[model samples]
Target chain A: MLDNSMKLEFPSKSQNESFARVVVASFAAQLDPTIEELADVKTAVSEAVTNSIIHGYENSLGIVYIECEIKNNKLEIIIEDKGKGIENVNEAMEPLYTSKPELERSGMGFTVMETFMDHLEVYSEEGRGTKIKMVKEFKSVSIKE
Target chain B: MQLHFNVKDENLIVRFTGELDHHTAQEIRNKIDNKYKNDMLKNIILDLKGINFMDSSGIGLIMGRYKTTRANDGSLVLINVNSRMEKILTMSGILKIVKVYRNEDEALHNI
Candidate 1:
């Protein structure tokens, strides 16, 4: 039984986006993901974390929390932020429907997550927060020596 | 993130050697826009060979540049995009709008 999990809490700063991505990718590495699979997890994590820092927290400062778990050959990640939540998750997920066009947002965050991860779920409430849970399963898992 | 700029003919070729995401998009955009404005290049070519990772923010950056370049009556093209980045760009359906070339020379010749 190889089940491992970790938690992280950091400021919702734009710079932390890359930090979060790298951390989750490192955790998922335990499953022996391929280069492409690793890249996929990194991209998905980046998107979710960016969403929390940008759309969720907006201009205000808040905390971004991340929890990662490994079970079997699947990696599960949950990125949550207690900031301004999405009014409509469905509309937000629609590709190219950016609410911040002035900021040059392509509105592909949710789309990218769905594309890269095996499963994706988003939960949010106005004036509350947003939580994104994503999972990726490695098809070829090798036991470590 | 670092952006290396070079002017060839009427094109402004920018080589990006870092990850492209929301955090670095603004700085990179500002630099490219400044160069494009000052040099008055007729076309913009992005060399993505050095980019290791990207997200939707990269899409926004490219789209914004495409708009600015087109407004100048110019064109914007991409070169050396790896397979991983290609997958993200493909999902954005941006490949349909902006052309991608195998290399800078090919891009320069075609555009």
Candidate 2:
């Protein structure tokens, strides 16, 4: 069995961001990261959640399932949504390329995900869904006495 | 997120602590722009070390400041970057225009 792993589900929205954060934090606890690292994880989670809401659901209603795993001292997060999947994952990952600029998205969600995490992989198809998987290794871990 | 301003050597440094989502970007842009008019600003540095989360709205803020700083014949620098934020900056290629430093001291000295 994996020493650190978790999964959660939530409706896509700003308020549900906390739910995603909590899940990531729980899985990241073993890494014993500094407060800054913890914040980084949460911010990455926020971006993934935002994408699930904005792009996956396309401003409609949908469920987001998040799964996190800690292996070899690295944290991996997966955000999945069954909505209008991205037709071109590459275009969506580009910076400032949101389909809904009127919503003021800045279209940087995937960029942030790619930035904060050590590794990122996106899977999606039009009219299907999108799954964002991210990994981050804690550069520093605290030791408890 | 709210902002904290630190002024030294006539350079204005803004530290953002909180989420820079779409809802807050416009107000932040206005506030920072207003500060420029309020004083004879020389250089500006943004200390994003405390920023936990940001979206495209955050990008807009940085781009706006880049423009504002250039118009005044000054420069803008961003410091205390984490990986996630670094990725965003890299993707946006803001590094091509704005300078990013590891710390405020470094940014201040170089600016």
Candidate 3:
């Protein structure tokens, strides 16, 4: 029963992204994922965390929470922000999509998450908050040579 | 990320250091695109010697630069890949399009 889950809290912002990724990667070690799988997880984490920092907080200060759990051979990550939630999650999930293109964001956050993970779910409401749930399957782990 | 820049026969040798996740991707893209706009760059040698991490965003960044260089009739070469990122690049089908060199000098000399 290695169904361990971690709760993470960070100040909502982009600068702390690297820090958050490292933290999440360390917690996700139980899956014994391949380097590629790890990177995929990290990227999905980045997309969600970036969304929390950029879209959720809108550059304002807030609290971001990430929860991870391993269940049924799948790694589940939940990134939530207590800030202005997305109005249209469907529109936000488009590839190469970005509400703020000037930021050099590919706007492919959800697309990236979907591409890397086995599945992704977004729950949001305007002016309330947003929660993103992602599940990635660990089939065969391959260590780096 | 760390960048090592050198000039060889007017080609730009930019070696990346550290992770190439979403955080550093824009900087890399902008810097290289700026070079494409300003410099008389004939070729590019991306030395991935120190890059321990990369993702699909990095993949997009690479492909975008590949198209830019190909349009300019210049070439883009990747060198000194680590084990993991190399596997990703291989599976992503980048190896078929972009030439991989064993080291920086080979990439520079090959182009």
Candidate 4:
């Protein structure tokens, strides 16, 4: 059963990355997640939001949509951007492969998300946009007496 | 994020407080690089005791500094990494290239 959900839309700017991370972490707090779990979610959220700002919009102004839902012990996050999408996700996902090396990007955005989350799915069309959906299950759900 | 730097011998110790994300990585990189260039520091010791959060952008900042230090034949070390930041650094394979120390004294001694 879906107990709670929230959606947020903001400009694809670097500053908003922290905002996204805090919002997601605060929402996940209701699940009584451990500090490590919260940090994992926050890190994953920051990476997704940063990608949307840098790669999706190419630093230009665009909208980034973030939707989060909690079902039982699972937390699902969907980040979508309506901007220049990826050409080849496989190549993009490769570690240390960055289109904008000049920006000093490590090209580990997707890899970090994959490592910290239980499941990650990315969908993109070159001219359209990119959507990243990730899910993580909370392991420390507090039981009310 | 706030950054403070102290120069000891040829080593530059950078202490970071608050979050390290894309918003602050570029600024931090520029500041550190500028100091490195101006002072010709040979080693960099990153004090991570106050960093509560970090993302991939933080990794890029460290890697960039590592390259700069290597180019100058210097070294970079990390100290006081909390468990959370440790996990991120470990997963990113930064622990392999950059050495981690439990205290500033240890890092300075090795550098």
For model 2, residues A1-145, the per-residue Cα lDDT tens digits are 2457777887776677766776787678778787667766877787778777777886698899988877766787888999999988899888778887655456777777777678999999888899888888887854444
lDDT per residue (tens digit) for residues A1-145 in model 1: 3899999999988999899989888888778889999999999999988888888999989999999999888888999999999999999999888789999999899999998899999999999999999999999897754
How do the candidates score on chain B by TM-score?
0.98, 0.94, 0.92, 0.97
Question: How should the candidates be ordered by lDDT, best one leading?
Answer: 1, 4, 3, 2
User: Residues B43-111, candidate 4, lDDT per residue (tens digit)?
Assistant: 999998888889999889989989899999999889998888888788888889999999999998878
Worst 10 residues of 3 chain A by lDDT: A136-145
Rank the models by TM-score, top first: 1, 4, 3, 2
**TM-score of model number 1:** 0.98
What TM-score should be assigned to candidate 3?
0.76
Predicted candidate 3 versus true structure: per-residue lDDT over B14-108, tens digit per residue: 87878886668878888877875677787888888788777655666777778778998998888888776775566556678999889876776
Model 2, docking class: acceptable
Top candidate (TM-score): 1
lDDT of 2 by residue, B4-108 (tens): 887887689998887776546667777887786687797889988888776555776787787788898899999998887776677777788888899988988
For DockQ, the strongest prediction is: 1
Each model's chain A TM-score: 0.96, 0.90, 0.92, 0.96
> Distance from true position, residue B71, model 4, in Å?
0.5
Q: After superposition, how far is residue A129 of candidate 1 from its true place, in Å?
A: 0.3
Clashing pairs in 4: none
**Selected candidate, larger DockQ, 1 vs 4:** 1
How many Å off is the CA of A28 in candidate 2?
A: 0.6
